[model samples]
Target: PARFEEGDTLVSWLAEIVGFSPSDTRLAREVPFMQDTSTGRPAGKIDLVVARVADTGLQWYGLEIQAVYFSGRGMQSEYEALQNDVDPYPPFPGAVRRPDWRSSSAKRLMPQLQIKVPTLRRWGSKLAVAVDGPFFESMGGPSSNPSRDLNDGDIIWMVPVLLPKERGGFLLSRGHWEVLTLEESSRKLLAAETVSRNAFEQTLLEKLKPLVRPTE
Candidate 1:
C-alpha cells in the first residue's frame, strides 16, 4: 500500500483487458495533463493510459486507482503476535487499527478525480477507475451511483470482489461496475454529512473550554 503496488497491479490487469496484442497495445504511465496556467507545465498525471493502435488511429482510456489506506497503530505488533499463534490461521490485529476511509476518500482520492477526470472528459476519453469493494461501499456507491450495462459514463468504476485462491492469497475478480458523470462523482466524494446546529455548537463549546484557560 505504501509503494502503491495495488495501483501497479490494476494497471497490469487493465493493459491486459485492453484486449490487444502486446505489439498493438501501448502502456503510458504517469501521463501528464491539466497544465498550470502560470508555469505552463502539467499539474497532474493520470495513473495509467492504455492505448491501442487501431486501423484508424490510437484509442485509449485513462485509468485511476484508489486503494484503501489504514490509519492507527503499526502492523509490527500484529506480526509479532502472529508468530506465537499455534492455529493455522493466526488471529488478526493485535493492535487497534482501521481503514482510514475519510482520509483516503475525501482527502486523497477526491483531488485525483477532480484534477484528472474533467480533462479526460473534455478530450472525449473515458476515465476508468479501479477501487476495492470496501472503498466503493464506503461511498454508498450502489445507492448513489447507478449501475449500467451500457458503457455511457464519462467516469467508469470497476469494483472488484477479492476472491480467495484455493491455495492462498486472493484474486481481484470483476464484481461490480458503475457509471457516473463528473458532477455525480464529485458529490459522492464529498461524503461528509451535515451536522445539526445544536451538535455543532456543543462540539464548538467543548473545544473552546481548553482555549479559555481560566480567564482572570
Candidate 2:
C-alpha cells in the first residue's frame, strides 16, 4: 500500500460512491474548527469536507480517509519501536510503537465516531469514512443483526476494490459502499479482532495478484 499523494484521488473515489457530480461536490480542505487559545491556532483542520445531496436532502459530510502507508518521523519512529518489540500497552513502560493496519485504522476512526461524527451531526452534516477493503474486513465484516438501533444516524463506509489494470498499474475501483448507522458500526467494531500483519499482507497480495503482469 502506498500513501495517496493527491487528496483528489480519494475525493473522486468517494464522489463516485456518493454519486456526486462535479458541480455538486465541494472540496473544503483543512477546514478550521475553532481557535485554540494556548496554541493560538485553530483546534484542527478536517482532512476533507464534501457537500452533496442525500436521499433526505442536501447535506454536508466530514470525509476522513485513512491509508495503510505513512511516511516521515512520526510513523517511522513508531515502526522502529515496533521492530524493537516494544509493547503497545503501558504498565510495562515499553516504548510506544506503531500499531497494525487494522488497529491504526481503528485508532483513527473511533475518535471520529465519538467526537467528530456527533459534532458534525449537530452542525447539520454527517461523517463518512472511506477505508480500504482490508481494513473494513478487519473490522468484523459488518454487522448481521437487523434489529439494531439506528438512533445515532447513519455512518457511510465507502470501500473500493483493487482492480486489475490492463497496463502495469493497479486501480482501486468498483467495490461495495456500505451505509452503517452508528450503532451498527459500533457493534461490528466490538466484534472485530486484530489480525496479524502477515495474514493481512497475504490477503492483500492474493487480491492484487491478478493485476500483476506475468513474468515472461
Candidate 3:
C-alpha cells in the first residue's frame, strides 16, 4: 500500500469506486495544458480536472485538494456563516459588505471556474480540501482581519475530510464552525469508494469520524 499525500487521488479513487470512467476522471496532469487564462501565463503545477459529464469537451470542473485542518477554536463560527447566507461579498473597499459567491470568484485570481453542469453550478465549483490536522487557531475568519476583505470568489465552498480524528474532531472553540462527523455523513461515500486500505479507512471511520462544514 502507498501513503497518499493529497485528496486528489482519493477523490479520483472515489470517482472510480463509484464508476466514473477514464474519459471522465482526468488527473490534473492529464488535463490539456493551457496557460491559465486569468494569469495569461502558466502556473507551475495545476491539480485536478474532470469533464462535466459523459461528453463535455475540455472545459472542466476543476478540483484542488488541500490537506489542511481547521482547528477547533473558530471552526463552528466559520461553518455558521457559510450555512447561513448565500450572498456575495459587499462591494469593494467601503461597501462594507460581502459579495455573492459567483462574482466573488469571477473576477480574481481564480476567476469563474467553468463548471461542467449548469445545474450543479449552484452548488458552486467544487473545491475539496482534505485535511489530516488543524487549519486555523482563532474563530474569526480571514475576513475578520480589518486590513483584509476575504472575497467569496477566492473559494466559495469547502469539503473537509477529516483524516485524523484522534487528534480531536476539528477541535474548535464553542462559537466557531460546526464539524460533521465523517463516519456519520460519509458512511455511504466511504463504502461506495474503494479506498486501498479498507481496514484502515474503517478503523479511522470509527476513530476519527470525518466532518463536512457546509457554508451558508
Candidate 4:
C-alpha cells in the first residue's frame, strides 16, 4: 500500500514524540536494508537513527515503522525474518523478529568509525518500531477467548473508531472477527489523528537528536 519513505516519516515522528530534537540527531535517511546474497531473503531497512548523549554516556538508537498489513501474520515473526534474512518455510509463522539494520550497519560503520573512536560493539543496541494498525482484543474483554494471548509488544489486531460520544468513544479491538466494520474504527482514527501525528513528531525529534553532529 505504501513505500519505504512512509516508514522514514513515521520514525522521524516517533523520535520527536519522545522529546528528541531534530537538529541534535543524525538522520541516516534511507539506509539500505541489504538482502542475503545467498538466501535472497527480504531484509528490512532502518528508517531513522538517533544518537542520545548524556553526561555519563552516549546511546545509539535505531527506529523502524511497520505500516503494512500483517494481520494473520505476526508482527514479531516478520521482524525476525527480516533480521535473519531468512523467510519462513511454512510461511506466516507467528514469532517475534528483529531487524538486521543494526547488525549489518554496525559492521559496515565499525571500520569507518573505528579509526576515530576505536570502540564499537553490536550488542546493547536499542531498537524501536512503531506499528500502524488497529487494536486486537486482549484478555479480560467481553467474549474474550483463552486462546487469544497478546502481549504488550504485540500489536492490536482490530482497527480503531473515533465516533461521537453518543455513539461510543472508540472501537478498540476485535480479535478473530471475520468482518471488520470500519464505521466505528474510522471515527476513532479521526479523533486520534491529531494526537497520533503529534506523538510521531515528538518521537522523531527525540530519537534524531543524538545523531546530529557538533558544529565545526
Candidate 5:
C-alpha cells in the first residue's frame, strides 16, 4: 500500500505508532535484546521499543517495522535515463523489480523474533510489527487467520491504511490489524510444504551434476 524512505514518519507521530494512549509513553530504537554467548557482544536489537509506566511497574512493548526491499538492478540507470529525456513523465523501468519478501520475513525478521521473543515472552510483553497490507499478504497465507484477543496474543500485527498522495508518496492512515500467538505467526511466516526424501535427493543430484565433471 505504501513505500517509505524509513519508518521514522510513522514512528515519530504518536498516533501512527502506538495503539494505547500516548500518556507517559517513551520510545527507544535499536534496543539490544540478546548478546553473543562467545563474544559477549550484542547479537540482536529490537528495531523500536515503546515504554510506559503502569501501576505495577514500567511496561514496554517491542515494535518492528519491516520495509520492503527490492530485488533487481540498481536505480542508477533509471536516474541517468531521466536526466536527458525531454519527456515530462519518467521512463519505464530498465529492469524488472520485485519485493524481496522471503528475505525480509524469513531471514531478517524471523531471526530477530527467534532471539528476542523468548525473553519478551517470558516477561509477558507484546511485540508489535508494522508492515503494509500487501507485504504481509505475500507471506503465503499465514497472516490470514483471525486475530486473537490483544491480551491473548504475543504479537500485534499493525497494518496501516496508506492513501495515495497527489505528488508521489502516500498518506498514512488507519489500517486493519489483528493479534496472533507467536507459534501461529512463526508457522505462517515460514510456511512451506515439506518435501519427500526422494524429491530432495533428486534436487541435490541435479544440483551436483553441473559442479561435478563427467566421468569418462
Candidate 6:
C-alpha cells in the first residue's frame, strides 16, 4: 500500500479505538496549514486531520504517521538529513535552495511531540501519532524521550501489535492507545537504538511467520 493508504488505515483504526462510529469519523489528508508569503505556496501541510462527532459536538485531532525504516546508512542519520532538507532557509546567503517536502522527516516525530502538540492543543485539537512497529520500537517503545509534559488527555500514541489469530495466522492489530507520562517517555528515549535494515526485516518476518500460510 502507498504511504498515505497505510496512514489512513492507522487513523481509521485509531478512530474505532477512540469509540467513534464510522459515520462519526472524518479524515482529511494533506490538509494545508500555512501559506508561504514569498513563493505563494503552502508552508505547511498536515498528513491527516481527524474529525469526530462527540456528545458535546464535533471534535478534531491531528494525526501524524511515521514509518521509520532501516536504510543502509542509519535511521537517525536519515532523520537528521531529512530535517536539514526541510529547513525553509539556507545556512548561507545565496544558497539557492527550495523547500523539498520529500526530504522532510515529517517534522521529526520527537520535535512534533514538543512543538506541534502544544500548538494543536491551543487550537482546541489534540495530537495523535501513529507509527509502524519498527518505528515504534526504534523510538524506544513509543513512550520514550518525551520533551513535553504530557497528560492522559493530551497527546496519544497509536502503535500496532501482532495478535495471534484463531485461523493459525497472526494478525497485525492496533494496540491500546498509550498516553505517555514524562517518566515513561524519558526512559524510552534512553533505550532507543537504531537497527540495520536487514536485521529489521528479518525480525519483522520472524514475528509474522506464524501468520503466513503456505500456498495450496
Clashes of each: 0, 0, 38, 48, 0, 4
| Residue-level lDDT for 165 in candidate 5 | 85
**Which residue pairs does candidate 5 place in steric collision?**
none
TM-score (all chains, Cα) for each model:
0.74, 0.60, 0.28, 0.29, 0.76, 0.55
Clashing pairs in 1: none
* Tens-place lDDT digits, model 1, residues 23-63: 77677878877789999998878777888888878888887
For 161-183, candidate 6 gives per-residue lDDT tens digits of 66777866556666645766433
**What is the Å distance of residue 80 in model 6 from its true position?**
28
Off by over 4 Å in 6: 1-8, 53-57, 73-107, 142-153, 162-171, 181-216
Report the candidate with higher lDDT, 2 versus 6.
Answer: 2
The lowest-lDDT stretch of 10 consecutive residues in candidate 2 is 143-152
Model 3 weakest 10-residue run by lDDT: 172-181
Ranking by TM-score: 5, 1, 2, 6, 4, 3
Give the candidate order by descending lDDT.
1, 5, 2, 6, 4, 3
Please name the candidate that would achieve the greatest lDDT relative to the true structure: 1
Cα deviation at 14, candidate 1, in Å, is 5.1
lDDT of each: 0.74, 0.63, 0.35, 0.39, 0.73, 0.60
Q: Candidate 1 or 5, higher lDDT?
A: 1
Alpha-carbon RMSD, each predicted model: 4.2, 17.2, 22.1, 23.7, 4.0, 19.3
How high is the lDDT of residue 171 in model 6?
A: 61
Q: How accurate is candidate 5 locally (lDDT)?
A: 0.73
Better of 1 and 6 by lDDT: 1
- Quick one: best TM-score, which candidate? 5
Model 5, TM vs. native: 0.76
Worst 10 residues of 1 by lDDT: 1-10
Which segments of model 1 are wrong by more than 4 Å? 1-24, 34-43, 76-87, 149-151, 196-216
